[model samples]
Target: MSSNGSVVPRVTTRTLQKMRDNDDPITMLTAYDYPMARLLDQAGVDVLLVGDSMGMVVQGHDTTLPVTMDQMIYHAEMVGRATDRAMVVVDLPFPEGQIGIERSIEAGVRVLKDTRCHAVKLEGGAEQADRIAAMVTAGIPVMAHVGLRPQNIHVDGGYRLQRDTDRLVADARAAEQAGAFAVLIECVPSSVAAAITDAVKVPTIGIGAGSAVSGQVLVTHDILGLTTGYTPKFTRNFAEIGKAIGQAAADYVAQVKSGGFPSKSESFS
Candidate 1:
């Protein structure tokens, strides 16, 4: 039973596979709350990702690893309630939930059942391929993330672009073999991203991984021009809504101070 008194219809795994087979581009946006999810759905977004990136976007954390499964479930459930269209894919945050295949499966199933999401996403490639395989075998759909894995920030010393084209290619293949429906390529070279997309059977969604991949995913704040901090160079600002909002607020203040607001035209009879 869904919280909204409506049937929770799942975005089927077969629909995702069909998108891959048809070469249709997959569109995903990171949405943390119900209103954002509802707006994204109205805008015709194909996927609503309840990304653990929420730690940074919503909780003011420096990394995503600190987000717990309970938090993830709560956020996912929130987005699920507001989403009537578009598939919701929730993230499996670092360290806390992804201990092993069993742990991942247990966590993933809980997220799907509790939040009514279509799938779950995790960071890693070949090193986590076995876990991906296990999830698939357990009937859970998985989206594998490679390249700039935020969960590895502590070990990698920070967010750095991955080189090693050969290793990258191998990792992508491993992900495909592990039955990932799609793989997210982040902060890798365009040539490498293109090669990986071609080498794998599933689709590749790129984020600063260059244009050669099959699809694109961007953080909603960065794309909408609402984020407070510095955005990546690859981020293209479509509408500086943050500045617009500030200007609008300033105008309202001035209007009220000058008795320009609630004019005769706006005054109630």
Candidate 2:
């Protein structure tokens, strides 16, 4: 609980591990700006990720590859300012952590210092262990991303489910061994996701994986039905907010044109 008497406790790496141990499912959502971060924090989300997906969802980019570290830091700082309890994790962005171990550490440090986020999330698994290790050794908490990495979208052709159970399990294990506090399992078969979750000591957060993992996450825009086109099959729209917003605007315009709005009560005395 905070000084404001909020029931939501502050989320941290240790808190996430404890949640996994207790069989409590964690909740995470992406927020690239302050308003969304404030709403998610108020709703008691366990984690708020400033994901590189913002490149597509917010900036209208075709891929996350073009998202720069400076853009991530700018958005992350806004999220950090709005959130008080949820653990904030920002993506290190493409090529930032993939350049080399030294470059990875530099990126991680810059992200933490500039954004005030709790940790930096980088895409990769066994192949990224050395970089992950170096970042952790530099005192930067890292959240490892395994399975389908968006940073590798061009190489992989497109987003596809990872079916190699053995590879998934090995990647998760390697990340844990490399000192990643948690691993995000994305776009993998349910069986593979479950296998990795079971094989890893650290908490596994799944996106389009399944319920058997430690937790689940989704892009906030997708969940709220704010995304305009090509929604993923795994994404579930919980609300028709986009339609509602459009309807509200139409109603306001009609009322104003008909001189039915800003009636006596809305007028100044």
Whole-model lDDT per candidate: 0.85, 0.91
Model 2, 105-204: lDDT tens digits are 8888888887768899989999999988889999999999999999999899998888999888988889999999999999888888889988987899
Q: Model 2's lDDT to the true fold?
A: 0.91
- Model 2: runs farther than 4 Å from truth? 1-8, 259-269
* Candidate 1 residue lDDT tens string, 127-177: 888899988898888888988889989899999988778888888899889
With a 3 Å backbone cut-off (N, CA, C), the pairs that clash in candidate 2 are none
Tell me, by lDDT, which candidate is best. Answer: 2
TM-score of each prediction:
0.87, 0.94
lDDT of 2 at 91: 94
Candidate number achieving the greatest TM-score relative to the actual structure = 2
Pairs that collide in candidate 1 are: none
